[model samples]
Target: MALATVGGCGSAEPSQQTETDDSAVVLPIIPAGTKADSILVDKSDRTLILYKGDEEIARYGNIRFGDTPEGHKRFEGDERTPEGRYTINGRNPGSRYHLSLRISYPNAADRAYAEARGKSPGGDIFIHGQPNGREGAPLASDWTDGCIALSNAEIQQIWETVPDGTEIYILP
Candidate 1:
C-alpha cells in the first residue's frame, strides 16, 4: 500500500525574513520557523511526520491511529481514524495529553456525508501526545480517542515547528 503522504511535489520553503546588521551586530538566537506544509500519518507504520513543503523535518515514531483503521471516520464512537485531507485548526496547551494540535476534520465533504445521514460528524480530532507524563504509552499501545498519538518530546517538536492553520492530509 502506498504511504498516505500529504501535499504535492514541492521543495521545503521556510518563510524567512532576512535582516541586516549595522555595526557588526551579533545574533542572540536563530529561529527555525517555517510554514508547515503537511502532516503525514501512516497508521500501518505507526509514524507521524511533519513536513515543511516536501522536506521531512521531524518524524515521530511510536504513533497510533484510531482503534479501527479500516476506513474514514463515520460517527461518534466509531473508533475509526479519518482519512483524506485536513488542516491544523488550533492548538491546546491544556489537554489530556501533554499538548495537542487540532485537526480540521469534517471538511465540507465530511459535513455533507454526515448531514446526508442525519448524524453529527463527531469532532475534537487532534494530533496529540500521550497521557500526562505518560508519553511513553503511545510507544507501547494504540490508545487514543481517534486522534493521532505522539510522545511529549515529539509533540513539543511539532508544536514548535508547525504553526496553526497549516494544511494536514491523512490518507488510508
Candidate 2:
C-alpha cells in the first residue's frame, strides 16, 4: 500500500549545486546516461526502487518473492529472501528467466548465521524477470526459491538501467 514511499541512503553524497557555474555540475553517482546509481528492495512492500543519488528514479511494484518470503534466509532451500546490503555482482542476459541480475547473497553475516545453525547458506540469488515459459514462474507473492521476481519487460528495463556493482539494499 505504500508503494509511493521511498527512502534514500548511500555511501557517498552527490555534489551540492551552487551559483558558481552550471559547468561545475558534479557527475551523478551512476555512469553517464545511466538512470540509477543503486537500488533498494523493500520486501515488506514488495517493491524495488532505483535511485540516482538521493532521488528515487524508478519504482517497480507488485514484485514476487520466495514461498516463505519472511525473515532472513537460513539455508540453501529456506525459500526466504535475504535482508541487508548486497551488490549487483553479475548479469545473465540469456538466463532461464527472461533476464537476470545477480545479487550477492550469503554475505559474511549470513554465512556465519547459517554456520552457527549448521545449515548451508544459499547462494545464486537474483533479481530476475519471469521465466521464458509456463506463463510466469513467480506469478504470486510467494513463488521463488528466494530471488526477487519482476515481469519480463520490467527486467529488460532494469537490465538497461542498472549496471553491475550497483549497491542493492534489501530490507525486511
Candidate 3:
C-alpha cells in the first residue's frame, strides 16, 4: 500500500488514536421577506427594477440574458428567455452559478405549447450570478442557457430581499 504525505516531503503515517474534530462556523443570517410590489426585467436596458406598488425601491442593472434574445421562449433548447408575468417560486443556494431565485417558467400556456409541439418543457430557469468562467468578466454580452444573470453580490442581495412567490415580469 502507498501513502501520501503533506507538503510531499515525508511518508504518511496512520495515527493509532482516532481523533475527530467537531467544530462549526456560524454565519450571520438575513431574514426572508418580500418588500417589493413587482420585479421588472427590461430586456432592452438589461436591468432589473424592484418596485413597491408602483414606487421604485431598488434597481439592479447589468443583467445578462439568453444567447438569443428574440421573442419569448416557446420550446425546449430555444436558448431564449421567457418574457411574461410570473412568480418567484423558490430559491436555490446550491446553484451551479451562485445562489439563485427560481422563476416560475413554463406556465400553463408554455406547457400546452410544448406539449402541442411534442417536446419537453425546458426547466431550471433562474435569476442567478455569473458562471465560474465569467465571474470576473465585465458584463458585456448576453450569454446564458435561458435565464437572467446577475453579479454575485447582486444575487445575494436579491436572495435576501425577494422572498418566494414574488411577482416578476420580463419584458421584450
Best by TM-score: 2
| Candidate whose lDDT is highest | 2
The parts of candidate 3 lying over 4 Å away from their true place are 1-34, 133-135
Q: lDDT per model, in order?
A: 0.64, 0.71, 0.68
RMSD of 1: 12.8
- The digit string of per-residue lDDT tens for model 1 on 72-146 reads 987766767788888887776655555667787778888889889998777778886655544123445665647
TM-score of 1: 0.75
Order candidates by TM-score, high to low: 2, 3, 1
What local lDDT does model 3 show for residue 137? 47
lDDT of model 1, residue 171: 70
lDDT of 3: 0.68
Q: Record all residue pairs in model 2 with backbone atoms less than 3 Å apart, i.e. clashing.
A: none
Candidate 2 positional error at 118, Å: 1.7
* Ten contiguous residues with the weakest lDDT in model 2: 1-10
Flag the better candidate by TM-score, 2 or 3. 2
